[model samples]
Target: MRMQLETCLAQAGGRSDPRTGSLSTPIHQTATFSHPRLGESTGYDYSRTTNPTRSALEKALAEIDGGARACAFASGMAALDAVVRLVIESKRRRVVCTEDPYGGTIRLLEQFFRPVGVVPVYVDTSDTRAVLRELDAGDVAALVAEIPTNPLMRVADVATLADAAHAAGATMVLDNTFLTPYLFKPLQHGVDIAVYSATKYLSGHNDVVAGAAVCRSEEMGTRLAAIQNAGGGIPGPMDSWLLLRGLKTLAIRMDRQQENAQAIAAFLAGHPRVARVYYPGLAGDPGHERLRRQARGFGGMLSIEVDDPDLVPRALAAVKVFAFAESLGGVESLITFPTVQTHAAMDAAIKDRLGINNRLLRLSIGIENVADLIADLDDALR
Candidate 1:
């Protein structure tokens, strides 16, 4: 019988070891495994190529995302690098991407992919007409979309985008980091590839930094696997084990996180110091209805713009509970000044155009008490 998602997550690495009846998946920490003889071998040879712990983690990820296979990487960027390489190998030199994506993604495309002749085209993916117009130009190899895009929380119509991409002979790659498989499954929405920054929600504690790519088809899975092995960016066995452990509690963490986020978004939306709130959970948000139709939940990320730019630093310093930090998707609530932190690498022109300005603040809500979290923000805004 096929288990439900919550059950699958709760039992992520359980019952894998029949030998000693170990409930936890054992971490196989070694550079290489020994073969019994010249003609025979264990499934794992080099740790770099394969490790028992990583393989188990990968299997769990594939099952969670409903993919043919999943590949683990050292960092989220490394997984994206492998995916880009796969696109390059296919000889489709151009990639259409979501506008206002994570700054690191823009940096990678400009600094790395551009020099190597892979063109990156950025558009507002929420605007399906704009995406279709771009696709009409044609040499596109892949369309990399961030579901409810970074900081802004703008939701895209994934199934519609995927259909357009396929008609244009392109692969649809979705960054499902904001909403993990617990909230949304990209494959079910017609996405060809589902990418994740496992360090965030998947490894909810923020301890392990890892990345994953889940391919919809076995053919794409084989190709991505080749890129992952050749690129040599696989995470260590320990990190993989930690991520697997993290996966076990994904459902509970996400539920509480989103619940807190909804209350906070509502609070911010009505605040005197607040200028705008960008969270799909809010009924007034532009993407709220679309996200409601496409995803299981609105996720725990929200961005707010204060009436005064000076309020940015003051709030960052005054916040009691929310940490003033860089990365997101953890158990602790974080307040980030995108202009200087996560999106600092982004171009000033694009920043202005997208409202990623000095007054803008991104929040990663945690599983904290709703009243306390709201009170903290209210105090900080003052």
Candidate 2:
């Protein structure tokens, strides 16, 4: 029988030994698993291709993402790289992506993929008409989107985009790291492939760096697995174990994190120094209505535009509780200026087009007390 999300979190990958009844899944850290009689062994043969611990994590991920299969990787970029490789065959040479994608993804497409004959086209995915217009042109092999996007908090209509992509004979891939499967399941919304920086919300504690790809069909799963093995970006046994442990508490952690974020977004929205707040949870926000229709919740990420660019350094320095950091989706709150930190390498023109203003600040809300986080922001705004 299918289980509820909370039950899935607690028991999805906990395959206990019939003899011992251990509650937690043990890490199978060996580099290779021996076959008893030349070929008489379970599916696992080597660590590079598979490990018991990693298999557990992959199973859990597949369950969470509602996919036929899932693959785990060393980092989020590795997952993305594998997905991109799947679409970059000799006949299919171009990738259409959101103008406001994560900076690392932008770098991968421009600096790396471009040189290898895979061209990347950036479009404003929020504009459904524009996205459809681009797909009609037909050079695209894959279309990638990040819902309630990184740093910008731009929400795209996944089902709409997926329809457009399918009509154009292109695959639709979504980076669901920001919202996590708890708040949004891209597959149910028509996404063909769902990718996650498992290092983020899935691993919640910020202790592990990992990535995952979940595909709707066994064929896509095999293709992703092939690229993963060829590229050698599979996650280590320890990281897989930690990620599995984190998955157990994902529901509870996200409940608190989402609450903290809503409170903080309210605080920032009314602050005099704040020019604009980007959060789907806020009523009447452009994406709020659409988000209600497509997502389970508004998620835990928010972005604010300060009135002046110069105010950023002062505001960043003034915050007493929130840590100034680059990566996000940790147990502790984090604040960063993307133009200078995460998206520094992106072209200035591209940054402007994506509305990544110099004065914008990205906030990754943690499970901290709402009052305490607000007070810290109140003092910083002063």
Candidate 3:
């Protein structure tokens, strides 16, 4: 029988415990597993390479993303590191990337990949023509795109980008963190690989630190599996268990979070202190129509620019409900000054060019009371 996504979310780990009929997946927290015989194995030899709980989480991620396999990591950056190695291994050293990815990604590229001879060309992916120009220019091995870019909420034509990648003989890697599988499936949109920071929406409570990479085909899956085992950056069994638990309620969490987000975005759009609102959920946002074409929902992430850059600290200090934090997509509403938090590592020149500055604040709306959340922001603005 063909099952729906909502059904799969509730039953993330369908791999039931055969011995005790335990509904929850047990944590196999040992470094090594015992073998019954000298010539036999239990499928899981070492925790580093494989563990029951971790494998179950990987399976659930694969099922949700509609991929052949998923590789779990200790952190999102580690998963991205694996992708970089995978792309470089293809012998095509030149890569094209979206102009603004997470600051951590840019740091990794400049500090690590560039020194090794791999070149990255950055372009505004929201403009299909710009992306196509870069791809057509040649020698591009991969295209790493964030569905709707960080902080800015800029949308790119994923289907079109994937086609361009394929035409250029490059692999298309998508960061689907902003919109989890509940809102969008990048693999179905012709993306070769979809990576996620499971620490966010996948682990909606913000308790687990994990990452995932889902492959569109078995061949790619096998390669990613090799990277997972070889890199030794895999998450522990307990973290994996928590991620699986978080996935079970992903649909519900996102529903409430986004509901709050839409209301807040509407409120901010008309506010006197607000200069600009960056969210696809807004009817007049430049990327609103583009988002509708590729995703099910606009997501709970949004960013705003204050009327005065100097007032940023005042607002950050005054927020009562929204935590002045570094991360997002958790159960608690978070207010981040991207210029100092997420994008501080980015070059000042690029920051000015992209408008990621002191005036900008990114919001990660949670499953909190909409009215209360609004009141909290209202108090801060005053």
Candidate 4:
């Protein structure tokens, strides 16, 4: 039976313990499983290839995203690395991607993939015309987009981009880490692969560094499974169980976080020290209408540009509730300066063009008291 996402998530590992009825998924912490006899198997021979705990998490992830299958990895980069390998397998090895993706992604592509014949192409994915123009050149292997992008909050029309990619004989890969399956499911909107940093919102807490990739088709699922097995970047059983625990509360956490973000975005937009606010949740934001048409909610992320770059350090040092740290998506609010933190590896020119400058501060709103969160920012800006 098809259950609501909330129910599905809440019951992530609920049914995995049919044997002992443990309710919680047990961690099958072992390197290899012994067979009963020769030529016979117990389904799992090696933990690297598969494990009961990880399989349960993978199944939940696939179901939540409405994908054919899912693979869990040690980190978000590992999941992306495996996906990149699949894209580069094409004779046309050129992959088009979002112009301002997470810096770590750019580093992976430039340092690792570029040396091995994989060509990376960057463009403003929210600008359909520009992405279409790049695809028109042909010889494109895949189109990777980070919905609402990182820090900038630029939402792309997924179905339209997916159609264009398919017409050009290219696969569409979406980084759904920000919105996650709770707010948006890229596969349902014609995306062939949905990528995630399960470390963030999917895990909900500021713990467990994990990543996942969900495939839309069985063929792609089989291929990605092979790549996962070869790469051997799978997470341990304990980490997989942690993800399962995180999934159970995803719906609630996301709802409260979005609520807090909407209120905070409004607060930042009207603040004297704030020059610009980049949040799709704001009705006047450029991506607001498009994201509304596609996603269920506006998400919990927003970025602000201070009136003076000098005020950046003051705000960072002044925040009492918000943590001045790296990474996002957790119960505790986080403030990140993208220029030197998340997007430091990106080209300086691209960062300048995208407005990811020293004055810009990215906020990952958490499920805290909305008033407290607002007051904290308000005081920090002062």
Q: Write the per-residue lDDT of candidate 1 for residues 182-203, one digit (tens) a residue.
A: 9999999999889999989999
Candidate 1: regions farther than 4 A off: none
Backbone clashes counted, model 4: 0
- Stretches of model 4 off by over 4 angstroms after superposition: none
Best by lDDT: 4
Model 3: residues with Cα > 4 Å off, grouped in runs: none
Q: State the C-alpha lDDT per candidate.
A: 0.92, 0.89, 0.92, 0.94
Per-residue C-alpha lDDT of model 4 across residues 80-162, encoded as one tens digit per residue: 99999987788787899999898999999999988989899999999999999999999999999998899899999999999
User: What residue pairs are clashing in model 3?
Assistant: none
Best-to-worst lDDT order: 4, 1, 3, 2
Each candidate: how many clashes? 0, 0, 0, 0
For model 2, where is the 10-residue window of minimal lDDT?
12-21
What's the lDDT of the predicted structure labeled candidate 3?
0.92
